[model samples]
Target: MVEVERLFFMGASQSSSSNSNGEVVFKTETPVQFSPTLVSQLADRQNASPVPTSERQSTLDDQIRAKIKDEVGKLRREEEAVQKQIHTALEKENLDRERDGAGELADGTDSGIGAVKSSAALMGDLEEIRGKIERFQVRKSLQDWPQVRESREKLVECYRSHKASSLECWKEVEGFKDSVRTLEKEYFKTLQ
Candidate 1:
């Protein structure tokens, strides 16, 4: 007589037996309906190992760096676009002022207002013109522009250096964004 034990896996049975001679025999019985292709595929997958932690971390780091670079680039471009809009608005306002000043001067002179003006009044008029020019020259002040530009530059440099992750520069990036927002608000306020 033989003592036998059987184990089952995936619809297959494996058996081991000890015969009277004290020899061991092993037998495996696979289901007739089992597909060899499916078994081989599963076996291959089971045998394949997962990526090492260090390699996986490296890949994640690369992805994060790429994403950060993309975000920074997008922000920089947006900032540039806003700056251009601000410049365009300023130019248009300046041109309007010039045309209005020219028209006002022509109207005043043609209406004989300048012909009757006293020397003191002319001096006051000149002074007023100088004041207007000075105000126009420093219209928005741009006190925040340099700070925003510097912060953006710092963020870009940090990313390029690759010594630190994007998360580390997040505060600087946010600061730049805030500065730009403040500048934009100031610009719009001036327009108003």
Candidate 2:
């Protein structure tokens, strides 16, 4: 469709208007039409640009990674808590057995570690620890059995010296967990 806009300038020649030679000159009216297609094309050009879906997806992926990392951090913290519990347990068992003198009793306290014969779950932990101990043993970190025996004697001496202290330590490491994994990294290092 043709759209016309009119602007009137009345009395151009008769109103003392002059030409380049200061002489009156007659002029005719001209028509101008606005093009709808050109206007629509200009607007469409702006809208035709691509959307940022890839950029948006990258932002979403980053958010997902951050959420996963947060969940993993929480799980790691829980795992550490469980390990500490196990450490305290083994330490107590070590002390009690020393006191009561257990030659070969198949303690039923930890069904997870039945009879010290390497039960399924405990065996895996034992194997992992054995690897670490092998490395530590190479480095001479863990004491020999004789030295451990001497240390056990000293532990008893300390227990005798302080009455409630041994029991206190036992309270922290109850159930004699019976798992080789009950040692913390630092204590395992000592075993090497």
Give the number of the best model, judged by TM-score.
1
- Give the alpha-carbon lDDT of every model: 0.73, 0.62
Instruction: Report lDDT (Cα) of residue 52, candidate 2.
Output: 51
Off by over 4 Å in 2: 1-52, 102-192
| Cα error, candidate 1, residue 89 (Å) | 1.0
Among the numbered candidates, top lDDT falls to: 1
Looking at model 2, the pairs that clash are 88-173, 141-192, 142-191, 142-192
* Local accuracy of candidate 2 as per-residue lDDT tens digits, 1-192: 122222223444344466688777665465666699988998897789666579898998999999999999999999999999999999898777654542345563444423443245457878999999799768643343344445455556666777865765452233222222333444679669
In model 2, the Cα lDDT at residue 174 comes to 32
| Candidate 2, lDDT over the whole model | 0.62
Per-residue lDDT of candidate 1, residues 1-192 (tens digit): 122323243223237676899986776575567689999998898779565579888999999999999999999999999999999999998767555554255545444334424446568988999999999779645553787778778778877866656678777778888888987887799889
Q: Each prediction's TM-score against the native?
A: 0.30, 0.28
C-alpha lDDT (0 to 100) for residue 81 of candidate 1? 100
